[model samples]
Target chain A: MNNADHPTQSPGNVAGIRRQVVLPLGKSIEIAYNSIRVRFFRSLITTLSLVLAVSFLSFVNVSTDVANGLLATGQPELRQALVRAGYDLAPEDRRADSSSKQRWIVLLSLLVCAVGIVNAQLMAVTERFREIGTMKCLGALDRFVMRLFLLEAGMQGLVGAAAGALGGALFALLNGFILFGGQAVRLVPANELLLSLLWATAAGCLLSLIGVAYPAWVAARMQPVEAMRVEQ
Target chain B: MTTNKNIVRVTNVTKTFQLGKIAVHALKGVELEIPTGQYVSIMGPSGSGKSTLFNMIGGLDKPTTGKVYIDEVDVSQLDAYELAWLRCRKIGYIFQTFNIIQVMTALENVTLPMTFAGMRNDEAIEKAMGLLDLVGLGDRFQHKPFELSGGQQQRVAIARALANDPAIILADEPTGNLDLKTGEEIINLLQNLSHERDVTVISATHDIKMLNVSDLVVWIRDGRIDKIESRDELTISVGRIDARNA
Candidate 1:
């Protein structure tokens, strides 16, 4: 009888919520959206911080690429004059990318972006400790909890990054025109600038995901009793 | 009691917590069996390990040694997937703080567990509405947790607990946050559900009034079962339910 039961031993025939399937991804996304909507002001602050950080980083990247593109147009006198004025021009052969100094600025901006994301995600995880516990008690799997947090972070990051990237690229274009006049538009390096914007937006999403990974793991692995024991 | 009739079995269970350099034994080879459909209450002073024992039975925590069996399946040996399966279908939890999803409406909160159970959306909503009506919150379906009174929030919680029609209901201090009058009402409701639905109700509580409705009361002292008494033996034990001892 024991072996006979083994073949048919999914929890019960009445309910289909066993190991065969998990809560739908769409439902988790809906829950994530609703949670963000419910905490409108908090979500706003998190998105705003992402926006500012991504904008700064993207602006740096775009302007650097524009500067490099204009410097490589084979104008030696112009380049020397620019170099004399404290501009660190790259070698002619390597005038294909942002300067090393500007790359460091990009890295710095990314660090600041990561710090902003970490703060927002950490706050979200702490606030949802009890809720996470309750969800676990209600049969939400570890993957489900992780997915819910990632979904929220991804949604916020995507929106903020897209807006920030576009805003930064446009502003960078305007700045380039002001500094180098018609020469700037003539050597716009539109492809490189667009690539930087894309990279910045992707970085925003990736960093948001990475920022939430630790907290999500912690939440998913928490003993429900320990989580529910917390009063606040 | 025969193992066949017992729905829950705790055998030689020992749980140790590491607190700094000290090892605190929460349960020391504790053995217990709860028959199907019994309304059991676990009572003890704080730090006496009753809550830890409750956690073991509820599958919220695994014992460091020995095993827990729910419906003949060894729960301590189950993986997370199987644990979630058991929690989703076999047992329901009602927290003292009424841990309903705070952002959703009362109706939405009750429907959540059903969704985890893979019920259809409309069907889940219909059942959830019925449950709310049963808990006397039918008219307040749209109210969020903050919008409801304490008693109302707890009623919603109870409704949520019953959403999946779990065979076992675990209430951890269900009436702890309510006033005496409301507390009594919640207790009566639980008692009625226990008899009416034939579901096993295990409540870890300090409310002395629970004695009136319990089928069995298990008292824990330190890390061991001090006594186990049926409803018939409760009259003799009622005098022992002191504030410090409970």
Candidate 2:
């Protein structure tokens, strides 16, 4: 280590003028994982909101795909069975189309999910105010603190979204079996269901990042907020 | 270079905090200097600018109207990056709450700052182990903060504060939460550590026990230094000096 500390009380001389390196992303991810595990219940609650919204979307998608596939089969026996099951085959194009009402519901549900995430994260960060202050006092840069929060949120989002998508897809399958018997399983293509889940999961993860953005920024830029607390 | 003896200097420092519509003067042109390798205690009643003064010295918050210098570097001049380096390498903070991360084990908590300073994991672990040993918590390295007693947790916090070998250790009422015996032990540990490491120890404390181990006691009243007394001066003013006070 160089004797880089100049001791002349110069105006611009920074103390301990040595190279500073940030802790790697891997270390932060590890810490974030540990924190989530320790606060498992809290994290579970945050993940639940994400799960509900993503599942709703995937359910709508998979159910539509199954209904479309059954309709597109076009065989008179299957069509007659579909009519018996209350299927409206007229004007139902090859492309699966959910009504505008369902689209509004999806948009509303996702917006609610995002708002829930932001609220939960903000409260969580507030509860960890002292922890954040301690880390800052220990020389954690703003970027490091931001990274920790984002990583934690991202992990929760990923887990919750995948679970929701799978659950919704499975539910759609069971509903299909009950409504149309063996024909339901044979008609619905698996690839469409898979595609719906992939995008649903990605959207959930992106929402998580956007949700955590403000709280993480608030956590990072503080100067050990407790510094001004009265000493008694 | 400034005198090697003085590690911290404060000149005409004032801090005004705006609560709502009015400005609260937290520090009122307070000036003081702490010598290297000395254990100094700052004492005051609540709302007397004790914490504000401490913040200025620690460089956790900048002064509103003056300057604070640590190791001859003007605190007000450094940007955030430079300021972080100063905090990381030049100053160690011990809080009253023993604010060790609750999720991390004692060893991990101690190693955190070192890793932040860019020490490799293996080396950080080795150094952290040595620090825990020094603080007498080597056997409890795997214990989380919740698992440790108040004193033991404080000891871990001490090890953490020393992780980067800071030139100054700022203890904010470190003994405020401990029982008398544990508090005394902590104070003695701090006193000895400062002497051995030749680092300045600055504590904002209410515990009179601190007066025994401290070489100097600074009393703040109403946003200004009321008096500063050497240990010898304090001893004579009260009664005959104790054997340890000598």
Fnat value of model 2? 0.56
Per-residue CA lDDT of model 2 for A78-128, tens digit only, reads 666656765555655444567778889998999999999999999998888
RMSD of 1: 4.2
**lDDT, candidate 1, B1-246, per-residue tens:** 342388789999999999999999999889999998888999999999999999989999889999988877788666677778777777899898888788899999999888987788899999999999998989999998999998999899889888888878999998999999999999999989988887889999988999889999999989999999999989766766563476
lDDT tens digits by residue: candidate 1, A1-61: 1222121235453133344336888888899999989998898888876777788778878
Task: Output the lDDT of residue A137, model 2.
Answer: 83
DockQ of each: 0.39, 0.54
Per-residue CA lDDT of model 2 for B1-246, tens digit only, reads 233468899999999999899999998889898988889999999899998898889988899998888887888887777777777778899988898899999999999999888889999999999999999998999998999999999999999999999999999999989999999999999999999988789999888788888888899999999999988888764455355467
B56: Cα error in model 2, Å: 0.9
DockQ of 1: 0.39
When summed lDDT is taken over every stretch of 10 residues in candidate 1 chain B, the lowest stretch is B237-246
